[model samples]
Target: MIAKLLSATALACLATISSTASAQSGSGQKAPTANPAQPQSQPNPPSSKPEQQPTSKQPTADRSKLIEEAVTAVRETRNAVRAIDQNKPADAISALERATGKLEIVLARTPDLALAPIDDAVITYDVIGTVQDVERIRAAAKAAFDRGRMQEARRLMDGLASETVLSVTNMPLGTYPAALKEAAALLHQGKPQDAKRVLETALNTFVVTRTIMPLPLARAQSAIEEGRTLMEKSNRTDAESVRLGSLLARARDQLRLGQALGYATEKEMSDLVRAVEDMERRTSGKQQARGMVEPTRPMFDAANKASQPPKSN
Candidate 1:
């Protein structure tokens, strides 16, 4: 009876162990392999998210430095186009594309860069005689596209776009003196209303013309034109005339400041100073100067011509 009990207990314990192993295996968990040469499988590493790299971004002040670099690159590309070897059109196109890339980086960030001054004057690309080169490259690019040279065509297109933008952005400054001269001529002819309109328009617009105007001279010209406009408008009523006198006084003050800064000629300084004083007297309900318009015309002509900077060779 004791032997029979020990056998039954051993059988029950073995059955429980078998049942547990079978359940674990049925649940998709592999039991350890009994073969000595086989190794156990490892579960996949905890599925971690990817690590991102840091970006290299610079400060805002260095943006101007980048603009200068882009300008230099554009200049180089323009120069390269002048001597492009026909057999190696790819080489010239590549250089131009690189320059375009540099420009694009800046343009994307600052579209108003056209209005930004590089060195006291608007940043000028001044691509000397590049229009013909651009046309030639465009023709080549079209031909390449026709021949299924897609890469070359794409490069040429990029270069053309960049060159076109640079050329457009290099617009010359307005001839403020010329406009002032026109205003003076009108005033001399007793057309003060027309003269005033001209002066006001010039002050309000980016008047692009074929004249080289220095920045300081341009500012001085605006002040003088404004003063002259105010003086002309003063002829209506006593209140209006008094207002004009006060404004002209301030305008004369600005001209004096410009003169001290060497922006105006000595002759201009004297003439405008005298004109403002005469305007003050006339507008103050006192004796008006005789032949005011005719006397001031020559002074304006001299000042206008003096304000014009010599054209670049």
Candidate 2:
């Protein structure tokens, strides 16, 4: 009975030992599988910070190119003026068109260019002048009494005249409108040659008003009208005796106009004075040439004549 009991105890011990070994092997296999899942939960290494990008700026080079193009256009316009003076109308027109194209480009690239305002004014003046010249030529080419051409010419003249009047009238309160009105009236009356003369005088008056300090441009217009009346009377066949008188009257009117312009405003009178001087100088030269006087003598006489007092109206 004691031996059987001891054998039973040994068998029990072996069974327990076998069970413990099996449990240890299962735990070892489960640990590896659990480790892989733990790896998924492990936080990823911190990501590196993203780099920044750069920004763009305005192009100075583009601005310079735009300015250069504008300057080139101005030069081309001057060339066109020269061509017009030489009576090459077709060439002048072509050059002016090219200049206009370049100016358009300049405006597109740099609308706020500093010289844009002055350029616009110049363009308006030049284009109007050209339009007037072309219309005058077309009218002259038309058959006499061709109502259609005459009407077309008159229409164009009216538009230019209205524009001129409006330009002057829109100026500051002190600016004169009389000269502009007179020029418009002359153009409307189908007197383009007379209108051109009036317009020239008006331009001078405008310049003078900006410079001198007393006489208004309206006064100059009145003087020009008086001169025109005298000129018309001198055209009569029986007016030979009064031709010299008429010429003298016209000279006096111009002198009065110049004097008025000389003292019109309160700005810089130098420009006005220079313009008046140039006109007087040119008129004097023409007169001397007509009298068959020596070039030097006529020039001197002109200078002296311009300095003398003007005759009464």
Candidate 3:
């Protein structure tokens, strides 16, 4: 009876043990999952960090290429000017228009050129004078045509065509500092013409005021007008005549300088010359001439035109 009791107790203990083992196995099959928001723990090697990519260089501008293109355009313009001078108006006009288009493209792309080292003053003056000359040529052409001067009108038109090209001839090179450096080298090499061409290109790169005369010419004109007004308004005397003579002499000097610099147009210079001649007659004679205003009026008109800024087209 004691042996039977011992066997029954052992079976009960075995059954409890088996039930516990089954529960543990079932729980083991259902593994714990990682939270979606949390990062899975990673095993990293000792002293190891993330790898880095190499830095890339930024793209640089090709200023030399830009300057070369500009120089080529200027040479084309110079050639076009020569064509115009040869009296091929139609061909010259077409060439000039093309040259201008090329220059405008260069100018539009390069804003740094304005601050670049160059002769901005002389270049600006040259361009403006050329532009103004072109306008005057157009007017002169019409006037010549009206007065039955066909040859004169044709010549004026051709001149206008040439001026159009000349106005923009050296523009691109003028704006680039490197071009000036190259020009300096050419000068040192004794290629003055080549150096001159380079400088011209640099000067022609930008346009400024087209109507305002160069400072010296403008000042001289003012002096002449002031003297004329004083002569006409005040009492005529030897001292007054001498004063007027001094003023005329000063004006002549200025005009001469302007001519030397190729600033004033032939017609403009002629008008000034006429005024000076009339003033000389007045200053040298006993009394102021009755027809002095006639010659001087044209001179004043020319001066006035030079002083005023060009109207926008």
- For model 1, what is the alpha-carbon lDDT of residue 81? 43
Tell me the tens digit of each residue's lDDT in model 2 across 49-161: 01111111114344445445544554555565465456564555565466557666755664433232111010011122222243444344354237556665444333221
State which candidate has the highest lDDT.
3
Candidate 1 minimal-lDDT segment of 10 residues? 19-28
As for TM-score, the candidate ahead, 1 or 2, is 1
lDDT agreement with native, every candidate: 0.40, 0.31, 0.42
Model 3 clashing residue pairs (backbone): 170-201, 171-204, 171-205, 173-202, 174-201, 174-202, 174-203
In candidate 2, what residue range of length 10 has the lowest lDDT sum? 162-171
Q: For residues 1-313, write the lDDT of model 3, one tens digit per residue.
A: 0011112222222222221111100000122121101111112111111111111111123333343455555555556445545645454445445545555555566643432111111111212232234445556778989999998777655421101000111232344445545554554565656655765665555533221325435546566766866557445677777777788777676565454334446777666766676677765664554446456555544543443333344
Question: How high a TM-score does candidate 3 get?
Answer: 0.30
Tell me how far the alpha carbon of residue 24 in candidate 1 is from the true structure, in angstroms, after superposition: 93
Candidate 2 residue runs with Cα over 4 Å from true position = 1-58, 114-313
Query: In candidate 1, residue 192 scores what lDDT?
Result: 52
How much is 284 displaced in model 2, in angstroms?
A: 75
Those runs of model 1 whose alpha carbons end farther than 4 Å from true positions after fitting are 1-238, 286-298, 308-313
Candidate 1 lDDT score at position 181:
53
